[model samples]
Target: MFVAEAAGLDAIAATGTLRVPRTIAHGISGEQGYLVLEYLELGSRGKADLLGERLAALHRCTADQFGFAGDNFIGTTLQPNARTNDWVGFWRRHRLGFQLRLAARNGYGGRLQSLGEQLLGALPAFFAGYSPQPSLLHGDLWSGNHGFLADGTPAIFDPAAYYGDRECDLAMTELFGGFPESFYAAYRAIWPLDPGYATRRDLYNLYHILNHANLFSGGYTTQAEQMMQKLLIAHS
Candidate 1:
């Protein structure tokens, strides 16, 4: 976990688009593992607009394929990042399909699996003309994962870094509540989202919701099912 985390932090920092706590070192000590990082005093009162602009810049960092050098975790669950040139296939196999299989193994089946399979089959329709470059992503981006340093520079941390659709990062930001309105506006000012983004946002965010359901095993299951049903209906 610590090793993957250090790699992820280094990946984001390499972009130089936004601030991340510098990764100092990571290794196992005795029975425990540790990742040492340069500390920063974070605060919510920092510039939301700046956060948005910088985040947009971060999304500009791109790659040829959709994945990372290796797998990592999304809050403890192993997140597979096998590189692929096909974005839709990558999401279906690595992101959504992987989670659904895990959910079944954890005894969440029946309606959930039925709906998830349908959604997976329908995934191609969501991409239509939208071929996305594999942008560097803060794969676990949510409101809690971002804040500002004492100097008011926007800083994002605890990344599940990968090369995927930039919309994955943007979608996750809106999943758990959301960032401020200024954040969205500023981001659009830098690089406007696709016209189909409203629909695909849910599709991208489903990955995280499914991850949450797998990790916590509570209302998130019902939540993920509802989200899948809603998505199927919308696409249908």
Candidate 2:
């Protein structure tokens, strides 16, 4: 696990997609594995246009395949990322299947499971003609994971880093809310998202909400249910 994390971190740095911390140290703290990363400083304009432009450039970086060297951790759980040439297949297996299975184990069955299956089946149609290359992504790129440096440069941290669809990166940004209008505008100017992206956004976000429901069962269950229903309606 540590080796895989190190490899992904190295890949991110090598690609110049996002800034990887200078020191990625691993050690044993009792029975658990610990990873220590350098701290990044944030400035006042965390959502500045320059940072937006940088993130756009990062997302534009792509590869021939859509998978990582190995799976890594997200929040505290292991994310299974088996390598695959097909972007749709990779997403189904690692992103959708893995998250849905975990959610099911945590008592999120019935409608949630059914909708997940449907979404998986519909992925190809949803992403038609969009053969996504392995883009360097800060996989868990929600609002909280990114900040601006002292000079207003964007600094992304706590990456669930991987090579997958750029839309996944954009979808996550909308999930929380730190991203500004300039960010989306800058990204569109560089590499425009597909028209179907709006439809797929809810489907993609369902994975995260379901994961949250599994992790902390509060209002997330209801939220996940609602998202699933919305997707079902769209597909129908």
Whole-model Cα lDDT per candidate? 0.91, 0.75
Off by over 4 Å in 2: 1-5, 29-32
Model 2 clash number: 0
Q: Give the clash count for model 1.
A: 0
Misplaced by over 4 Å in model 1 are none
TM-score of each: 0.98, 0.89
Q: Which one wins on TM-score?
A: 1
For residues 1-236, what per-residue lDDT tens digits would candidate 2 score against the true structure?
Answer: 66556666666677665566654698788999877777777654755566567677776777767777778877767887777788778778887788888888887788878877887787777676666667778788787776777666677766777878778888988998647888888778778888888988876777677678778889987898788677667766
Candidate 1 global lDDT: 0.91
- Per-residue error at 229 for model 1, in Å? 1.0
Q: What's the C-alpha lDDT at position 120 in model 1?
A: 94
